[model samples]
Target: MTEPLGAYGSVVEMLEAAATRAPDHPALVCEQVELTYARYRDCVAALAADLARDGIGAGDRVGLLMGNSAQIAVATFGVQAAGAQVVPLNPAYTESELGPVLKDADLALLIHDAGLEELAGAAAPKGTRCLIVGPGARDLTQPTGAPPAPLSLPDPQTLSTLQYTGGTTGAAKGVDLRHAAVAVNVAQREALLPTGPDERVLAITPLFHVYAVAMGLYLAANCGGTLHIVPKFTAAAVLRDIERHRITFLSASPTIFQALLRDPAFAETDLSSLRVCSSGSSALSAEVLHRWEEATGCAICEGYGQTEAGPVLTYNALHGPRRAGTVGVPVPATEIEIVDTDTGLVPLAPGAAGEIRARGPQLMAGYRNRPEETAATLRDGWLYTGDIGRMDDAGHLVICDRKKDMVVTAGYNVFPREIEEVLFAMPGVADAAVVGVADDYRGEMLCAFVVGAEGDLPEERIRAHLAERLAKYKWPRDIRCLAALPKTAVGKTDKKELRQVASVPPSEPA
Candidate 1:
């Protein structure tokens, strides 16, 4: 019987327990490198020692700015092992883009990749200790097999991570995750992924994000499973590696699933070992979900959560029935409450749109250093998950739209998702993001940024296409065809950023 991990003190305790039980097992794999439990254990210890030498101790925030690599894994574990909270910065963040996170977080040390050294130099604090961890990075990847250098770390209840929620809100703030909270979230994620000691899982998603950490590292740690970490996400490379490693599980967003399904060699690839797939970060379109399940002959489960909640609120298990668009029932030990904006959680009889409210042990400590924002978000012990969704008779939660993302035309409420669903049903539209832009006539006009099939799909053609299925008001007045939509860290269309760039002052009329 698997002994459930109730309250492991820290990452050090978690890794040590996993290692002591299975030292000979391979703990991690990233292109051309395989690290056993014992080797990985020593690596964590040495890396922790190095961190303590550089003045990073318990609860201190260090930025992890790098792509998906074995070193990235080692660095994350190493930072936690040294008793510091790691703020995983998105590699795409420019000096200006990264400014908010750097300013928001009380960070002193930055372990950035050499590729980002210039940006790091520009973004680093006045007296920040920034270390490069890439090709020319001085931090050695090879383990020296040293003991952990000691520090006066607080109790395990102290914050271990400061995950920044994706944009929509103007200035991003950190979600403080306590040791107890993370353990609950990790255990919930591990419960859903059917893996074992010998089995290997693909880590194609960005490890900087919460979803990847929950699935790739934490889940793998619990089962003592091997993590096949790809450097970055590329459909062709992912397919090749899946066959090469006999990968048992693939965790990713729907965009990745669609890309994989489109690959010509997808059929010929040796996908015999694939056990199941789990998708989140965005809604998985119903059509694509069915297509992948049809093609691969594997179960694809839907999981949903946010960075503020240690990232797992609900997940689909293998035993339950897989609904088409639902994000499954509440994860074990997680609770759900749907409420109206004006009032508290009023249980809708059935099939009613309301804001999703969740309160559980897996919840984060609070937003780091932003007490007012934290107080507003984490109120009365429940997270007012700004997402609008409903519970069905069967208990599955179906998210309709973000509370802010829902478009309002005049006095009537028009959910962008309602229109996007109709657009996705159309043959040519690949993906879509609908937002309300300013208009002189209507209060706000619905505008769409769409990615069409590989061809010249004109705005009029798209308008004509949606006109058949949508109401006149909901039909997007401005339809912009995109090569690919800009994505937030969690893989959803970065609509807020898109709106910002779209609304940039018209160059002062040049």
Candidate 2:
């Protein structure tokens, strides 16, 4: 493990270097436009100056609500350079969800694109300084205005971002990532992957997601790597874009890999240029990993992180003893402990499966505005990640289950991913939820709400498919099928809504 960079250097060093060394190189790509590094740095400097002019400064929170684009990257860099804390919010967050967060974080500045203009404008704090980045927003591809008076950064430990987490167990809380922590994560990221100044990064993951916020934007910024930002991920489009840019680095989800692997054109793409393809946000199934490696000739290295620890805990190094199922050994400067789930203790044995807990320089200072919750989560300076996993003798980690009441149906943890993965395999199963509905048996009977796919993938056959894989105790006892399963943003099955529909007795055909 490399000694952490204690003598903090300026993040602007990265932007400034790209500006000088690779002035004409494409730094960020979206749609048809590409932003050069020189233009990107100048735009950041200008935007930083603009925010300072708007009364936003170091220690103030600046909210950004938009999809992935060159503007988001520039705005993020601008916020950091201007010495303001960046709060990246998901554009898809409902008004109800978005309201409390802005208030809690005490946001004074906001930037938004058109799709979210209606929701974001309505949510902006009154008298809050604001900037908009959209189709006609700030021609960010081109620098605007004079070089703003540069803002001096505080100590590296100063707050950098208040990123929102998934909040599966409770309301969303802001994870306070300090500049030192983010810098540590990025420095370690660069060490692990070792990219050159000339490499291009194809970033399709949403900028709002903390992984992208830290690893995608900040890491690339720290290394002077060119950023190719895709607003969203589509297999066909990403395939074309990768070849178009000769992209070398990719940060994305397992689903995107599955979609690409399923494509007949996947084999034809020049994915050979991509040296580092990383996946997080969900488990990259061994099956999907195998298929991806076969199709692209590049292995999917699983990196692990959460919003609380400045978003990166462990990443399979580009060259090291990279494990397939485990999230890999702890990163260079991080310490992770997998302990007994219920006992709240670390077991002596190497193969024990337990809750994953970690502490490091990258750890968040704390959650914003939630003391009790913060105390409950951050125990003894260690963030108790709710993920269940086991550590091998080699010190690798393998995720087993979630501590919360949830189901991981086929890699998409059905936080409500549904009773599907559990119930799908039961004997006599049509379909099932294994959900709780004031059940008389076992307090919560494993009920299966199943349906037969019409032509080939029928319910019984699906049950058979599952029976061979899952343990019998985990199988659903009761099965029923509706026309469809409910879903939330990003398309995970809505089990809470399904519980309501399950109350009605299954109808029988005459």
Candidate 3:
């Protein structure tokens, strides 16, 4: 039987323990700034005290709107330390996109970067207080001349984080995660892919993303390791950081790995220090996997999860046999089964494709103020993950596609990911996505968008490639070549945008 990894009551406690164990150890590094564990803990305690004085405490939702920075990390843990839930928002959101979420969250305070004051003021509802930190504003990472106060620690079930979804399908809903759930997930991930105090982790993704929070932020704190933060992703900068910092662990998306391979510096950069690398947020193509491992001599362990599952469900095991095409077995203390999509009650045998359902300590409490959606998504103590997948005989999970993204052509059902994989393996194809569009005769037709390696790829070439690997029913009726595919905030391909583009009539099918 698998047991829980640690006994921390909350994620804040995890940070405090790390600080006590290694006060002088490096905790965070972002560009020219660095903080020791002792100093980092002091900053968080000071922020918590200030927030308490301002009347922000339990039940208050505090919005953190900013890009990747050391200060954002301080604000995330500090708000929770003060007994309030932290609502991390993507700073890239426009006023229109930020308004509804701000209104829905009913935040008591919003902490944002300097340049976003105008957008925060315009979008946030009246009476919602705003705090700016960054250039020309107060620094969250600095102590405010006040002695640190005793931490307002939370119990296991106390709500700690309110993470908003990407809303690719529709409006984003808040995923409510409690203190124990978030902290336990860090231990769960550590069980599968262990890290040590000597580890140096490079975080290139946005800190607001759950993937970055669990695997990058919390994971580093769990082991008292150094976390190197990058404000933005550029192939050149990432390559330089790994070699400069002697980064040992990297967790990134397949898009980032692909971009790194294309950069000229990737070949010369020293990645010898990298010990464990993980890929998540989207499917990792086998071609990219093979290329990356061959070049770096390091395996890429791809995991699977949604924001509702505390963002991590399964990851390739570090100490055991690692598979190429599977997301690997469930993390410690997690139970997963493939259930029929119609009812989501009957469990299917191995190799049968169905909806992936999971029950674990890492599961979220529910959607915030969305009782009906919570009920529909969580039934009988199981999270009916709208993802479709199958389990192999060895217990490895194979993700097929999302239930909502499945396309029906003529009378047959088709999964776009299967065709997208084939396109990814083709020569001169840099990126690809498949979406279903409304059709008169077939009810729904598949449309494919391809990004080329160098220049515009011939449509006939893509058609010929698909015709040989896929059946007649699976072929996309229309093909389009793009310079680059649109991406969501978390770096997944924006299929909704592609569907909108595919709906428009073209002079001829590419």
Candidate 4:
């Protein structure tokens, strides 16, 4: 709730203060176990001392591979307090998916949940030491007699987290972010969606994601609120926890929200304690939004950000207008502009679609070890987000599409989001994803992959819906019906996979 700390402040400092100020307050909850701020701080201090003893020091990159739980929080704070940069790995990642990142980062150490020890071990480089936590895991020990070692606090410019970009478009790259930037980003989120000290935040999304970390765990700690961590998302368990804990705030993806809406007990569950719900990672369909609001009496505020900007740029207004199709005005201390993609200099007029350029304290330093990519993305002090969007007169920003996601067919530029939105508005559609497919004559064609509410949706019905709402050129040339659309680790549509599927022959299933 406090103003973002100045350059002198670091996340470690802020967390330490939170513990000191409210030692007796419940800081973290996971299932039946709850830890007070005092206990949390002591655990972190003990772990920090152990990590330091093991030679994990400033500038070292420590990879964390754990599901969402109280231990994840402890490891995050402990590793940072020991002055090491944390690289969060997806707990669900296959060895193939996680191997490249481990090798690319050249991690100094790997900390993983007991359940994932084998996966983490296989991914870790030969020399990187491993620390496992959870029941039956290797114990992290600190000497009993001596006082806990003092933390080596990082400076404002110190790299805090090496957040990997979601590879929906291409290969994921490591984004180098500073401690000050991460702290400011957390503060900006807090400012927009203020949670009371007594509030209970339900964090069902993976904690490794920037959105979940900022909106749920960090915000709760920063505001002296309690964070109830769900190791993995299950709609029934989530609903049970909401009623049991009287959770007031929730942050999840559109897919998760939709799943919750479809759960059998959704109508009967007591959601009266809920004050707000945040949707991100993908577009929330109008059907899902209206149904959820009508059922729960809570608004689903959509926000926007990417890996390079400490992961949060804007959010729908909590106290003012909450638009359905737009990611609202820029957060405090941030600047946004739509500019010509080619020149990156000419600022487009209002309501004109262009690539989004942003600059703020939360922007990352650059992409780690990729100087050319870094130079191309970070121009001057502004971060050129590859996302294409337009700003309305009211200052709300509507994303048109990703620059790479645009399909140029027969001299017409078509954004997939435009078609996908119309598909989502249809009655039988449960989920939809649009991707560009290479065509022999037109250069590129549209392909729509849709999941219906029940049974396969007829292709003609989808075509009819599109014909009425979109131009002929924008209509999908091919439609693929599936049980569910592919998703990335962060819960966004896996367009890269869809593009691959689109390249195959029509006889092949996606």
Candidate 5:
């Protein structure tokens, strides 16, 4: 097994070491541009110096509002190198969606894509300064006659990233992760899924998400490997890059994987270069997993995590027996427990279902500015993950569903994941989600929303399929099919929208 990158005070130090180890090696590749490790470090240092000159340092919050590109990657490390907390915002957010976050973060500077300048201006506060950057990071990489100023390296415990949670459940809260925590999580993931210097990582997920940063960006930097960034996700584009770039490692969501499988080009695409693939952000259905692995000959290692736990708590070991339908054991130094959902005090035995709680060095310090929530979530050294799951006898975790997403109808508790899995296995069902809507007699009713492979899906077919697989109570009271399901910024199914839509009367079934 390849050894993990030992230790780093901050993520910036990881980049510095990579640059020193392989100066001329390609570090970042996006579209028509590529930057070597040395050039990548130089761009970060240059941006850091510029931010430092503007009086942005420790205790200041800087927002990076851009899509997945070489420029955003540089800006991320640059802000942290200058000793400020980097807040990564989604450039796709409307001004209304961005306004509350802008006001809440109290940012000193917001570096954004040139195209998003108008949105940034409308959303940012009056005194907040905004810097516009283009696609290739040309402005940051340009040579200045004078040497760049020394970076203001932060203390290990200093707050580094203030990543906001995807608002799938409710309002998005900023997760406060320290420099040491972020660096340690990278090392933790490396311990289980080791990568070498020759590795080529393809990153289609948004860079703003913690999963992308830890698994895609920092993971590549730790090994002095090349990170290929895709600004957007399209089946054709991803398939083309994988074959063209000879990508060895890929980290993406189930939605992305399903799209690739549905594309006509997938059958002919040369995926022989893919050695490792990871799925996160949401659950991966058994049907999709089987199809993908059978076609590509690469097992998709499904993992479980949240933004609060440095975005990684557990992952399937690369060399071990990969279990189907379970997110594998906790990474090194992480302790996980199945606690009773009600009081969260009693520990449950293996094979018993309960809330999953964990404690680890990579855990976030707390949610920013939300003391009450922090106290409730982080207690007795454990982060109370509100996700409901069970630990198998073999120590693998089976995620049932989120606590809030569970349904109680006719006095029977039902997990949406169970029914959704059944839905995913049905032919013509491309994507599926289940939400509990209020009902007068049943207290709450299970409503399933599905996206068909080609056109409108027949509700009767879904009902017939569920009838054979699931219990009568587990069957959805209503089945609605659409062209596409609403997704959160991080590519999670937005159940909140489904619940809202399900509240209204159902139209005639297709």
Candidate 6:
């Protein structure tokens, strides 16, 4: 029987326990390099010593700015081992893009990749020190000092990570996650997607994001499983590695799954070893879902959650009936209720559309330094997820759209997701985003930007398709074909940018 992990005060303690139990097991694998549990633990210890020497202690924020790699896993464990809260920064951020996060975090030291030193230097606030990790000028990944003496375990409520919510709506706010909360989140994920000690998991999702950390890093570490880490995502490379590694488990976004399906090699690849594939971050379209399952003969379980809800609220079952569009049932030890959007107090009947509210041990403590926002979001132990969705008759959760993403046109509320889903089902349309643009006739007009897999789709064919299914008000007024949709740092389609593009008037045909 698996022992209860709640007794462990911190994530570091949990990791230490895993390392002690399976010192010979391979904990992390990046390309040709495999770091065994014992070696990984020592690296974490040495890095922790280096961090302690730099004066980062409990409650101090240590920024991690890098793409996904073995170094990220090592640095994350090392930072927590030193009792410091981690602030993960997107390495793709330019100086201007990253400066606000650095200043807002008020970080003691920013640990960044060796390749991003110049960007880090430009973005870092005055007096903020930088520690380079990865292949070169070093700190945590390569330690010169003796291994630090083990530190005392932290309190259960001690803050572990200040993960920023994806800024699709507005500026990203830091969500505070305690050690206990993170542990619970990882356990919740494992409950739904059970794995054994010998499971080989492949992770292509960015670790800086909360979803990847909870599902990929922590999940693999907790079970003492081998994790094959990909630093960047490319469909061909990901497919090649999956076949090469004979990976048993995979956690990725729908965008990646779609790309894999598009790649010619995916059809020929031997995926007999695959046990389960989990998709999140964005809604998985039915077309993509059907294709993947048909090709791989494995279910792609789609789950739903945000950064604040320990990053997982619901998942399709591993053994039971797996639904394609629905996110399936809530994970064990979690409760989800569809409440009326206006009052947020009354639980709606089944099949009713409402705001999704969740309560579980894994929920974040609150938003960091933003009491008003925190109070608004986390109320009376229930975290009010701003996403709008409905529960089906079978108790499965179907995410309709984000509350802010709902476009109010004329007198009707048109959800962009509804239109986007239709576009996804249409042949030749690879990606789609719908947003409201200013208009005098209908108060706001629905505009769509799409990327075509082959070439530009005929405008009339798209209009005719939506016209047959949707009401006139729900129909998009303008459709612009592009090479690809703009993506947020976490890889969700950037509707916020699409709205900006929609506002511009198109020039007359040349």
Q: Poorest 10 consecutive residues of model 2 by lDDT?
A: 409-418
Task: Give TM per candidate.
Answer: 0.79, 0.79, 0.82, 0.79, 0.81, 0.80
TM-score of 1: 0.79
Native-to-model Cα distance after best TM-score fit, residue 105 in candidate 6, in Å: 0.5
RMSD of 2: 9.7
* Candidate numbers sorted by lDDT from highest down: 3, 5, 4, 6, 1, 2
Candidate 4 per-residue C-alpha lDDT over 95-205 given as tens digits, one digit per residue, 9 for 90 to 100: 655777888888888999888867777767787788888888743322244556445577778899998763333355788989889888888876777767788999988
Candidate 5's residue-wise lDDT over 375-456, tens digit each? 9899999999989999998999999767655665643446687677778888888999999986654557899999999888
Candidate 6: which stretches are off by over 4 Å? 1-8, 139-143, 147-152, 167-169, 406-510
Instruction: List the pairs of residues colliding in candidate 3.
Output: none
Local error of candidate 2 at residue 21 (angstroms): 4.7
Cα lDDT of model 2 by residue, 1-510, tens digit: 222453244455556655666778767767776677766777788877777778788779889887888788888878888888889887766564577678788888777886676777666667655667676666655665666543445457678888875455435578888877877776666666666666778787788777766657766666667777877777888898889888888877766777777777787888888877888777777777887777677767887877787777887777888888888878767888887777566553678878889988888888888788788778887889888888888988887766766543222222322235434444544444445443322223345556544422455655565465443434455555655566778886677777666655567421
lDDT of each: 0.75, 0.70, 0.86, 0.81, 0.85, 0.81
Task: Give the per-residue lDDT digits (tens) of candidate 3, residues 1-510.
Answer: 022575787889988988888999999999877999998899999989889999999999999998999999999999999999999997866565578789989998999999988889988999889999998888977787866965668777899999987433446689999999898888888888988889999998889988888888888888899999999889899999999999999988777888899999999999999998998866677888899999898879989888899978998998887888899999988999999999998999999999999999989999988898899899989998888999998999998867766665643446787688779989999999999986644557899999999987999999998876665767899998888999999999998888888999777463
Ranking by TM-score: 3, 5, 6, 4, 1, 2
Q: lDDT tens string, model 1, 1-510?
A: 133645565555667777888989888888777888877777777877888888788758888888888888888888887778888887765464477678788686888788887777787667777878666555445766545443233357877888876434434567889877887677766665556777688888778888888877777776777889989778899999999889988887776787788888898898888888888776777887888888888888998888888888887776767788899888877888788866655756558888888988888888777788778778899998888899888888898877656554432235676567667777887887787765433445677778888754787778887775544656776776777888989988887876764554335421
- Distance (Å) between predicted and true CA of 75, model 6? 0.6
TM-score preference between candidates 2 and 6, better one: 6
**Candidate 1 local Cα displacement, residue 450, angstroms:** 17
- Prediction 2 global C-alpha lDDT: 0.70
TM-score of decoy 6: 0.80
